[model samples]
Structures are given as structure tokens and as C-alpha cells.
Target: MNALPALPDSPGAYRWFYADVTAGEYSAVFIFMVGSLFSPRYSARVKRGALPLEHCAVNFALYHRGVSRRWVLSEYPQASVLRQGRELRIGRSRLEYAPDGTVRMEVDERCAPLGKAVRARLVLEPQVPAAEELQLVPGLPHFWRALAPRAKARLDVLSEDVSVEGIGYHDGNHGAELLGARLPRWHWARVHGPEETVVDYHLPDGVAPLRVTAGVLGTKSERRPLLSEARPTSLTGWGLRVPAQLYSGNTVVGTPRLLESSPFYARVEARRDGLDVMGEVADFRRFHSPFIRWMAHFRTRVERAA
Candidate 1:
């Protein structure tokens, strides 16, 4: 496996895997608290399989507005490795792999600025005859493609309210010794009472072109574009409520609830601004690899205000 290109530590977002076997759905979501430089959070869940299982995860990423601190709890099972060093905080925790093959995880963000807890359990029985190998995209970058079919997201965040852009790629062998390789960036916004969502993402071609693919996901009743046609929207939300994020310790989580007409249902709240993000997921999946460890090395400070 080759090494993945370095992702800027300044501001970015990522996701974990959770297949709902109990609900007979394929479900997963990614959060992009892009440091409020672009406040964003993405969620998605799909129902397709027969046997039902909840896809769950507990993960968090830490970054200071202007401080040079960066740390994240990635990877699961065995000793939960804590990737920290370069101006960042860190820790290590273990997970509970159920006898039924369900994956349960717990992440605690303490003594830090921003913290969160996520719980996801994906159950895939593979009962139905295998569909034409729906081209499984390996690596962290392109993994979202697998979930794209059942995905419906709202990007209401960007550098500014201009046409946002991004791309998604797929690859069988992304040369990632530890994980798969993928690169994507987009802008999104909500329309009319937040009932409608739109996004524009870019997936560059070159390294893993074919393995790399891009598409847009929308409401179940509507047809989403496999490739975007309109420019991405620059949507922003999260007023003052944004704080230096942190995660740590025992927390409470409510049963995942599906938002009306939305693809996401689970919600976990940890401490954000001296207040607790109540009902936040506590245990989800995480990955610890060389790239993640490198990223965990430093803290990123927010840009200075004029």
C-alpha cells in the first residue's frame, strides 16, 4: 500500500463506518466542524438489508481556532491508540465487539476545548443474494461512495456564501498501507425552511481515477445526481455556540432518532461551550494509522481576525 497524501491539519472533517443490520439499512455519517471557519456536520443512514442492525460509532476531532493544537481519536478494537504529539492532545481506549459481530465503541474528550461521543452498530447479514459487487471503494477517502446511494446531506458551511466546489474518488488499491486513499471537498446549503439541501463536491482525477468516483445524494423521494450539475452552496450555521471542542469520560446517549425527512437519526452531545452536548453518541468506530498519527502531532490555531 502506498502512503496517502497529507491532509491539511488546519481544518477538515472525517467519518466512521456503521452498518445497521438490525434495521436492514446501510447507515453512516461524517461530521465536518471545519473549525467554524466553516461550521458543518453531515449525517446519513440507509435501509436495504433484511436483518437489522444499527450502525454506530463514537469519534471526535479537536482543533483550536488559533491555537496550534490538533488531535483526534481514530481506529478501534484492541488498545484504542491515541495519536497525539504535534501541538495536540491525545488518548487511547478499547471497544466492545459483540458476540453477534456488532461493533460498539466509546470516545471520551476531556480537558480539551471540543469534545463529542458517537455510538453506532452496523448489522449486515448478507442474506440477500450478493448484488453485482457494488464496487466497494477501499480507503478512508472513497469509502463514502459506498454510502452515497443512501446518502442525503446538507452542507450549510463554507469559506463564504459563494459557489462551493469539491470532488470524490474511488480506488481498489489506493496504495494506503493502513487505509484506502480518497480526496474530496465541497460546499453545501439548505433551501426554503431547511427542507431542501444542495451540495457541489469535486473529486480530482490522476492517482486513483477509476477507483475514484463522485456523486450527489438527496431525499429518498427525489432523484440525486450521480455527478453534480450545479455549483456547491456555501451554507453556514452555529453562532457563538462554537467553542474549542473537547471529549473525555462517561457520558449519556439517547437512542438514535431519525430526523423527519432526513437520512440521519443518531445524535450525541458532548461538552461544546461549557454546556454539555446532551444525547451525543459515546461509542463508534475509529482508525489509528500513520497518517492519523502524523495529523495528531500538532495543534492548529485559528486565523487572526482583521
Candidate 2:
């Protein structure tokens, strides 16, 4: 029931499915973008009436102890994308929304820039499934859904010759306008506790943050007061601002570690109280800058054929 709806064929319309798994020392995240929301090309061509479906992409990243181990963001020709019901395939990677209610991901991709092969498979069985659709921004066309808040997961990295079991998560996002055109910036975090998982979305638009917790059999979602940082925010080498310290109520979330850092996006992890968190702070608007868009190309591989 959580599979994405049929995509819009409008020039700026897009949809993507995202899944992440954390197993012991290994954590992996992947995104299948039908309209390529993060694509600089998409940002550039939208005004020219470029079809979002014509710029499909797949992004995969592996992390170990808060450091990037492998990364791939490949853009392929529209002809390379295949969709059969709730199942989708772009290039060599595939995602299946099965009739049995399990989600499966199979990836065979080359790490960006380096071109080293990274292959993996992940099966996620949802223990807590989120059913409602949400507005990513107030009165915006962007929609967000958490398909699985907590799942029993198994991840196998075939090329790396590794396998492990851990907790996993899945979500879907889609919108009618270019991402940068709809929202300026945002911070999102997912923290997993022994008995619960909480995902928070912080958008500084004079609105309370959206906080969702999956603890028992289902989930509790509400508007939460913004978190206060203990210390002043710090700037990254690329000039992005991030919290120096974070607190969940009276308790600190722990020291944050950088997993991936770039000019417009960052992924970090923090641990304490047996809680594991993965957070992302992004500036979609900055991606529209000519310089930033130019820098984005080196990290993305263009696959012209299936």
C-alpha cells in the first residue's frame, strides 16, 4: 500500500523511493529518483520544459563508522528506466514493492569518480509502516511518506563479500515543482532507539518541526517545538551551517560525526544512550547556483544506455 503512485509526466514533476539500512558497523542508503530531484540538469532544464522522467537516476552510499565507504550517483537515459506495476529498475539497480509486503533492493553500480564496482542486495520487512501522506512544506505540492519506520533488515554486499542484519527504514518523496523552487533549506534526522525510531524534519519557515516516532506497534507523529542547540552553529569548509551540539529534550544526542560532506549537502551520525542517528542537512536552493551545479557533475556519472 506504500508504493509510490503513478508519476506525473509534467516537466518538473518527479517521484523517488528511498531506503536505508544500518547493520552493525555498516550502514547503507540508496535512492531511486524517477524525476531526478537532485539533478543539476533537471534544475537547469526545467524552465526549458525538460521532462522529469527523462532524467532518471540512482544514488547509493555506504558508510562505516560515520565515514563514506562507497558512493554512486548515476544518471541514465530515460529509455533505461523500466517500471512494471510497483517494481522499478534503472540501469542495473532495482526496487520491488512485493505483494507479500516486503521491500527488496538490488544494486549493481560503480562507485562515483573512482569507478570501483559496488554491488549489494537488501531485504526489509516492515514492523512499523506509516500510511499517511504528508506535505513536506506547508501548502506545497511536495509529498512525503514513510513506508517503513522500523524493519527487520538483511543486507548483502556481494562484491565486498559481506553480510549483516540490522534495523532499516524506507520512505518516498515526490513533488510537482523543482525542489529548489519549493523549499529553500531543511534538516532531517532519523534516530533509532532500542524500542523506538524517531524521524524529525526541521524546516525554518516559522513552522514547528515534524517529529514522528515508531516505538510500539505503530507510529506517533506530531508537530514539535524546534530543538535548541547547546552551542553555536558551526560552518563547514563549504560554508554550510550545522549544529555544533544537539539535544533531545534535557539529554544531548551525542557528538556528531560526518559521513558525507559537500557544498550543498551533509550526512552525519551521532550516538549516545544506545541511540543511533543519521541526519541530513541540505540546501536545495544552492544547487541552482552555476558554480554549485558545475561541481555536482564530477560526482555524477552519466550512463547513456541501458
Q: For each candidate, what is the lDDT? A: 0.21, 0.80
Off by over 4 Å in 2: 79-84, 226-232, 246-250
RMSD to the hidden true structure, all candidates: 18.4, 2.0
**What are the per-residue Cα lDDT tens digits for candidate 2 across 181-280?**
8688888878788888888777866666787788686887777766564346788889998767555544579766778888999887877767778878
- Angstrom error at residue 200, model 1: 12
Stretches of model 1 off by over 4 angstroms after superposition = 1-58, 61-92, 111-228, 235-306
**lDDT digits (tens) for residues 99-202 of candidate 1:** 33222222333212233232221222211111112212333432222222121222111111212111111111111111211332211111111122121122
Candidate 2 least-lDDT 10 residues: 77-86
